[model samples]
Target: MKKKVLAAILAAAMAMACLAGCSSSSEEASSDAAETEEAAETEEAAEDAEAAGEETAETAPAADGELIRVGIINNDPNESGYRTANDADMKAMFTEENGYDASFAYSLKNDEQITAAQKFIQDEVDFLLLSAADTSGWDSVLQDAQNAGIGVILFDRTIDASEDLYLASIVSDMEQEGQTAVDWLESQGLEEYNIIHIQGVMGSAAQQGRTGALDAKVAESDNWNLVTQQTAEWNSEKAQQIVQSVIDAGTEFNVIYAENDDMAKGAVAALDKANISHGVGKDVIIMGFDCNKWALQELLDQNWNYDGQCNPFQASYIDEVIKKVVNGEEITEKTIILEEKGFDATTITAEDVEKYGI
Candidate 1:
């Protein structure tokens, strides 16, 4: 009987040990499964993030494969008729149909443009296209873009940053434009150049370059005089006010060298108000830039003396540059200067206005 009791106790002890072993094995299996699931979830999250990035770049990929993400920084289109055509061309080029996922920002202020550029860098854009509002204060932004491995293309006006900062530039020779306009002005054989210099927005490339030639010419001679030199900030109303003030002060000015057509028109209004004859063989010789259709028409009609052509349509060239960037092709030219010309009241025609007017 004692032996039978020992046997029963041993069997009961063995059964308890078996149950404990099964329980521990089950817990270990559950722990292993949970770890595996967590790892898979982490990997999936990473993949989703990578996919989102690809989507931004390839929002509308071309037939080949990769998508080009571009950020365009420019000035307001409403600023001038020239700007209107420029912006429209850019819009037409960087469309979804053209395999580009482009974002655009427009501001007349340099600080605003810089801020927009920062955001584009943060968003990891593939390329940055800029038409700077100011020529200086752009080094920091360009450095940031370089650090991010993004390509930069400059269109319209250029900034004062180093050449290495940008991949390529498609721009007009603004200084040359000013020189051309001034040369034509010099050829007019005026008795004396009593000038009212109506400048564009201060610190702008166009303003600096256009003003440079006339300034040097004036400084070298005694016949040329500055009746009034001021900034109209690219507004026709402000330009009108400036000219009206000069007229009221009895300033003997016989020339209006406005940096743009709109300002020239404003100066013309002032002349008409005072019944001062202008245009061909008139009291004042008006010179303007940007060759807007109406401004060229004024030239054809012999109401304005000169109009300098500032080529605004650079979209096709920009598109070609961007394509090369995406395809890992080499850019041979760092700077691309557009062809431009000057128009005269005697030489301008209606057909010229229809063909070359922007």
Candidate 2:
């Protein structure tokens, strides 16, 4: 009986140990399942965060194909070769095909130009392009633009503003252009001759440049006298009238310093009507600025003594600057000074005409 009781107690202890072992195994299995589920949840959360980050990045600020509002203030649409070409280039680049919104204004006076600039600023244009008719009277307008966060780009002509006022300039050096034509005239070996200076609008940059060299020459020399100096205001009829007046005044001038091709052409018309001998190989030597096709043809035909090249195609460069600024790219130079040369009437060929003629 006692042996039977001992075996029964041992069996009971074995049963309890088996129950404890099963409970511990079940708890371990539950703990392992919980750990796996927690790991999966952690991985899913990480993936969700990564996907959200990608979405934010995709929606972040980008410059690709962005709309840029550009404002252009230039001379009259019917101004001249340089301005005409510039207008065509802008039209080509800023149309629906090129994907830009552009507005343009034309003026021949500083106050009018400033008013146009003010309008652009009021409209909150992204950029402002200027071809100033006069150098002065732009400080206030430009300052207002800066205050409005508009970037200014000078083209064709420059202003007398501080360097920080404008972002860049794409222009021909007017002084250099004048000096080039005058220097070429000097090389023609003409010593003693009266000259008629048919000038542009007074105080304009072109007038300042084209008039400077001849004025200095007059101030220094006694042999070459300026028979008449008058402002044609870049008008052909006015130029003709000025030349006719000089002719009627009985002045014996053998050289004509017309500030532009149109004026020079007008002067030639006057000379022709009056039966005055003129041209490169004639009694009177003629010099003109702006290598327009017609004017350069005149040079090539030896009808003009010299033609100075003043490039007016500013759209390509202005486009480049706008793209760079939009893309956060660095510009190597803020103020780009385009180099130019004079085309001698005697040496210009057809190839020169094709390449350099406007």
Candidate 3:
């Protein structure tokens, strides 16, 4: 009877051990399943949050199809080929498809430009695109626009305002343009050449930039002589008049430094009428800026001399800035300098003109 009791106790012990082992194994499996489900849930939640963020970021501009009014203040469309091309570029970028409503005002005077800026500010435009007529008189206008909560962007011409006043400036370094032209002229090994420098609007950045290098050369070297220098006010007729005056005065000038192609064309027109030979490797060398297609063709046809490129197209880049800024993306640059090149009248081919001419 005692042996029977002992065997029953051992059987009870074995059954309890088996049950314990089974319970331990089941507990481990259940713990692993629970952990896997938790991990999946966490991952799914993270993915959902990421998707939400993307949609939110994309929704702001998508929802506001109302015209984001952008006001453009520029020099007159008849100013130059550069200005004309710039206007066309701006028009193309600010179309309905590009998600902006744009308006423009043109003036060659600072007061007029300031008035335009004030009007745009009153209209509550989202942004102001300014190509200032003069650099110095814009600080007050820019401050007013900033105070009114409108963003200002400088294009083509830069203002002398503090950096914080405007969002960004997309401009060609006018000083550098002049310097490049001077360097090219120096490379041609012309010494003791008399120059007739026809300037643009006297105090404007374009005129100031272009005249500096030549004036510096004259001041420093004294090898090249200034026959005559006059402000054409960037008008072709004024330019023609100035050149006619120079011709009538019997000025002994071998170099014509016109600030822009229009003035250069005007100078050349006077030269042609006076039966003066002008071009590269000719009796006179003409240097001009803003390589308009027609002006470049003149170079290709061996009529005009060197034509430097001043690319005036900036609206596409400005559009990119708008998309980034309005979308809350960080902008890496506050100033963008456009690259410019000088055309060698001796070697600039038709293909070069097509590819690189403004």
lDDT values for all models: 0.85, 0.79, 0.81
Query: What ranking emerges by TM-score with the best candidate at the front?
Result: 1, 3, 2
lDDT of 3: 0.81
- Candidate 2, residues 1-358, lDDT tens digits: the string is 7975676566556545554654565455556657887754654454443344323222221213345788989888786777787787777666543446789999887788899999999999999999898888899889999899898999887788987888888987888888887777777777786889999989877799889988887788787788899999988899999999988988888899999988999999999998988776798898888888888888888888788888876676787687678758887887777767788877889877877777
lDDT of 3 at 220: 83
- Steric clash pairs (candidate 1): none
What TM-score, to 2 decimals, does candidate 3 have? 0.73
Question: 1-358, model 1: which lDDT tens digit per residue?
Answer: 7975676566556545554654565455556657787754554444443344333323224223345789999999998899898998889777775667799999999999999999999999999999998888999999999999999999988778899999999999989999999899889877799999999989777899999999999999888888889999888889999999999988888899999999999989988999998898888999999989999999988999899999998886787687667668999999999879999898777888997798
Using lDDT as the measure, which candidate wins?
1
Model 3 off-target regions past 4 Å? Answer: 1-68, 109-112, 136-144, 147-149, 241-251, 355-358
Model 2 vs. true fold: TM: 0.73
Candidate 2: list runs displaced more than 4 Å.
Answer: 1-63, 109-124, 133-137
Candidate 3 lDDT, 1-358, residue by residue in tens: 7976676566556545554654565455556657887764654454444344333323333444255789999899886678788888888777665557899999999899899999999999999999898778788888989999888888887778899999899998888889999988888887776989999988877789899988988888768888888999877788888889989988788999999888899999999999999887788899888898888988988887788788887885687677667768987888998878898788988887886566
- Of candidate 3, the 10-residue stretch with the lowest lDDT total is 52-61
| Cα-based TM-score, every candidate | 0.74, 0.73, 0.73
- Prediction 2 global C-alpha lDDT: 0.79
